[model samples]
Target: MLAATASQTIGPYWHLIEDDTWADLTRFGAEGETVVLTGTVYDGAGSLVTDAAIEIWQTSPAASDIFPAFGRCRTDSNGAFRFTTLKPGPVAGLGNAQQAPHIAISIFARGLLNALITRLYFQDEPLNETDPVLSMIEDEARRRTLIATRTASGAWNLDIRLQGDNETVFMEI
Candidate 1:
């Protein structure tokens, strides 16, 4: 066996803070729809990015909810992250249009001081057919890049590509 080497001290804020409020507040039931948000965080070079913070938020299906509706999680060694969230309802879109049910995702990494915003819709969501935002993208394959799919176990799995081929489209505002 190899012996451990002496290590140098790190920064003062190296410890993590505990917050149990990360649990999904959405109620899950027989008629209620649920999605497993799973994805791999990556760098611009297409390498797996570990230990990056990924935060996602969406308006409640109830629609009467208040602001600051979001959830967050960190990626593991495999650059995989997952979250259990309720399906969002249609929200007001640009001008007189409306958008489909989608979850607003933001990525925070070493180089990013502010999070990069993106949205994830479902492949089978009927609202996608009428979504104004999705309608702007003429390419079906390009639009599908932002959509996630459900697994055999009833969880939604979304593989996020930071850069290069098949990358998830990031948006401003």
Candidate 2:
């Protein structure tokens, strides 16, 4: 029999139980590099979910060699995970729709055995206005959940709420 809360294990892609795939995220950081993607995951009660894990992937500027994928990191005591990666470039979208240059996000928490799929769009990207997914969301407040704002240093920070105010845009896939 499966664990009572087995369904909350998140997606297999998170692979938190496994250690082979874990990488030195700071390895990619350069001296004085202030670029960091920081965010916190919370449960339905608005409590921090320290046990959760988050993985993010994106194609580099040229959208080339998107294979083998990017990186994965687990949340710390504050339900936060940070990754040091170059800002991704825009990628083609479905049909005639074009997507903004954003990072594809997958989240897994204690109550979710499967990873919730989503994308994080940069706030500075003008393409966000015409992006297909953003356009699909008619609610301005709901659409804002998917956009990540940049800090004074040009690095970005996006806070994710699993089940509270400003919840991230989780895709069915």
Candidate 3:
């Protein structure tokens, strides 16, 4: 009989099997203002994280007949990941407050047991000023970590830091 590995951890190897096509949310024929979201993952030492899996889910376009509203991508050698999807609009938050147009993100990496959660709010999004969740963050600088900026190429980018001077603010959920 073959002996199972003493201690096996699932992560870095799992993303390799995921369909790269999932990186493009529009693959299901979603319609709307399509935008490219790209970013790099950084570890505590400010070094790039090459083996990480990232997934995003949005509700603006709604997960309907065509739009799954979810996508997953893996970091490359440069620690970069990208996704193409429709821009989301403001959605209802808990109670009567409204949430800013944002994408919920979950990240799985080599050193983590449970995935870290966060959100990506677009730069220049007026709704961000009044976002209920964002309002809860008292530090403007810390809150900035949740915002993604538009690059010269017109794509939005927001780097995630796993721990450092300006680490990304991971949500408890």
Candidate 4:
């Protein structure tokens, strides 16, 4: 019997098979408070990770013809990614607790055996204070890593750091 080859991580050529349109969740004209979420992905050395793939899942409001509630984007040459979508409302969590309005993030990059999971919470959301997930984080500074700041242009910005002192807080499932 022939031996099986070792499994390998996704290569840099992922973009070749992914359509750029998948990055915009509002491409079909979803209705709600639309905002542009933009950010860059960095590696352990703080260098741009140009080949990373980011997927966001919004859990709120029933899916409609316009809002599919999910989107995927690949980082550009500058390691930046952007998503156009509506603001998500609070979703129910364990034990009837409500989670803050946030987007679930999954990151796939080179050197990672498994995709990293995180979340993007809007800084201006009052519900963030009582969010089940955010409240569980004991370190205030680390909790801030998951919050996205609103830009002057009304867009939301949040960078994802894979490592280093400012590394993002990735969640385990």
lDDT of 2 by residue, 40-93 (tens): 777778888787667777664432332333667787788877776666666888
The C-alpha stretches of model 4 lying farther than 4 A from their native spots are 1-8
Off by over 4 Å in 3: 1-9
Scored by CA lDDT, what does every candidate get? 0.70, 0.70, 0.90, 0.88
User: What is the C-alpha lDDT profile of model 4 across 20-89, one tens digit per residue?
Assistant: 8888888888777888999999998989999988999987755688888899999999999999888888
Error of 4 at 20 (Å): 0.8
TM-score, cand. 1: 0.76
RMSD values, in order shown = 9.9, 5.4, 5.0, 3.5
lDDT score of residue 110 within candidate 3: 82
Model 1, position 42: C-alpha lDDT score = 72
